[model samples]
Structures are given as structure tokens and as C-alpha cells.
Target: MLDLVVLVSGGGTNLQAIIDAIDNGTITNARIRAVISNNQNAYALERARRHGIEAVCVSPKEYADRELFNQAFLDTVDAYQPGLIVLAGFLVVIPPAMIQKYEKKIINIHPSLIPSFCGTGYYGLKVHEAALTRGVKITGATVHYVDEGTDTGPILLQKAVEVREGDTPQELQRRVMEEAEWVILPEAIQLIANGRKEA
Candidate 1:
């Protein structure tokens, strides 16, 4: 089994999806070694706890700067010795500290088709808002390898969600999560487990 360390910043529906998929055999040969987060009160930690997995909060506010926090965060995750580091909902980026060691071992799930409503400052509902503003009829979620640039990683899988009339950002966000994000994220994990490394 591959050890996994999942990172999150908020409600961990994707994390929960991973947990459920593992339980149901949709994702096999991988176990969640830990869940790490920047927010102490993030519900993701609780989800990890419910699964009897280790949960740690390396709050950025506890550190003096981003660089320091990045070091501490990487240190904590490294302790888990995960073969795969999944960014389910993680917000921060660990560059100089982790980019080299983890490399393609890390993966992230984005709320849009990527290259469309993704990049720096485009996350959470902001992605849906951008797609709505652009009047796009189709938006989706993407699961990809984690690289240095924002959402610039090699894509593993993507599933499109239809944009309906009179859709709010919140509605679009929910639809994308239900229709695209939850499904493809776990499927991508399974594909990665089977050694599908193509972009």
C-alpha cells in the first residue's frame, strides 16, 4: 500500500471523498497516513480524526513568515513518509522546501477546467465566479500533478460540468464538486496508483 498524506485548508469534502472511495474499493493500495492543514479549526482535521488518522495543524500564524512555516510544514509531512501527497483543498504552496523532494509525487484538485479559471488568486468560489463572468457554458474540475506553478501541473483527469442558466457561484461550485471534483479526484488517485504518469 502507498502511504498518503493529505493537505487541506477548509471543509474537506474531497478528503472525505477519498476516504469513502478507499473504503469502497474505488481507490485501493493507498492509505491515508495523515492529514495536515494550515488552519487549526479546519473541519478537514476532524474528518481525519473520524477515520482514526493523524491530523496536524501547522498554523501559518504560529510562524513568523511563509518561509519558516513552509519548512515546519514540510517537516511535519515528511514525518509521515508518504508516497503520495494529495492537496485536497490545501491553500498554501511549499516551494523551496518541498518542491524538489516531492516533485510529481504530489497532486491537486482544481475546481475549474484549469487554464481557464485557475492560477494565482483563483480558488474556491472565485473560480466559479470567473467562469460565470466569462459566460462559459462548460466548466469542470481537474486533477493534476503538483508542480511549481499554480495549477500548471500535468493533468491526470478532468470531468466537465454544465453551466446552467441563472447559476450562482455557490451553485456552480457545488455542482462542480458533486459532478466533477469528487468523481475525478479519486479516479485520478486510482490511476496514479496504477502508475499512469502522463500529463
Candidate 2:
């Protein structure tokens, strides 16, 4: 089985989706080895523990500097021997060493369609707000390999959701999560689990 280690930094709604998919067999040939979070209080850890999956925290606060934290984080993840590292909503800029070590073995689910409201200073609700401000008729989510550059990896899957009239950023964010992120993230995982890189 492919051992997965999911990294999260928030409520972990996407992590929950992956767990549900695994439970229902939507994803096969793989299993979550652990859930790692940078936030000590992240609810994702609770979700993982509830499901009997190992949950760990490698917070930067525990270390002396960024370099030390980065090393500790990488070592913690490596200890799990994960075949795939999924970044569901991890906010930390991945250390360059980690990216170099894992390469295409790491994947991330971005809130926007990418090359648009992505890159630095764009994350979470900021993406939806930018999309709304730009008046884009369609906004979506993307799953891609994690590269050194922000959201500049090989695209795996993308699903677009329409921008509804008079929609608030919060509302649009919810819709995109439900319509696009929830669907394509798991689909990407399934594709990789089955030994296919494209879908």
C-alpha cells in the first residue's frame, strides 16, 4: 500500500474528504500513515487521531530557527516513510530541502485555478476575494505537484466552479471547496494511488 502523510494547518476539511474517500473505497491501494500539522491546535490532528491514524505536530515554535525547524519537519515526515505527502492546506512555505528531497512525490491542493490568484500573498479567502475583485466568471481549484516555486508544479487535476452573482468571498470560498477542491483533490490522489500521473 502507498503510505501517505498529509500536512495541514487548519480545520482540515480537505483532509476529512480524503479520509472519507478512503473509508468508502473511492481511493484504494493507499493508506494514510500520519497527519502532520504545523499548528499545534490544528483540528486536523484530532480528525486523524479519531480515525486511528497517527497524528504529529512539528511546529516551528519548538525549534530555535527556521533552519532547525525545517530540518525537524523534514526528519519527522521522513520518519513516517511516506510514499506520498499531501498538502491539504499547509500554509508554511515548504523548505527547499524538502522539495528537493521529495520532488514530484509531494502534491498540494490550491484554492484557486492557479497562475491567476495564486503565488505569494494569495491563500485561503484571499484567493476568492481576488477572484471576485477581478470579476472572473469562473473560479476553480487545482491539484498539482509541489515544486520549489509557489503553485508552479505539474498540474494533476482541475475542476471549475462558476462565480455566482452577488456572491461574497466567503460564499464563493465555500462553493469552490465543495464543488472543486473536495472533488479534484481526491481524484488526484486516486490517480496517483493507481500509478497514473495524469487524469
TM-scores for all candidates: the values are: 0.97, 0.98
Model 2's alpha-carbon lDDT is 0.93
Candidate 1 wrong stretches, greater than 4 Å? none
Local error of candidate 1 at residue 155 (angstroms): 1.0
lDDT of 1 at 87: 93
Give one digit per residue, the lDDT tens place, for model 2 in 1-199: 7889999999999999999999999999889999999999999999999999999999999999999999999999999988899999999999999998998899999988877898989899999999999999999999999889989999888889999999999999999999999999888899888988732
lDDT of 1 at 162: 99
What is the per-residue lDDT of model 1 for residues 144-180, given as tens digits with 9 covering 90 to 100?
8888888998888899999999999999999999999
lDDT of 1 at 189: 82
In order, the Cα lDDT scores of the candidates are: 0.90, 0.93
Q: After superposition, how far is residue 50 of candidate 2 from its true place, in Å?
A: 0.6
Model 2 regions more than 4 Å off: none
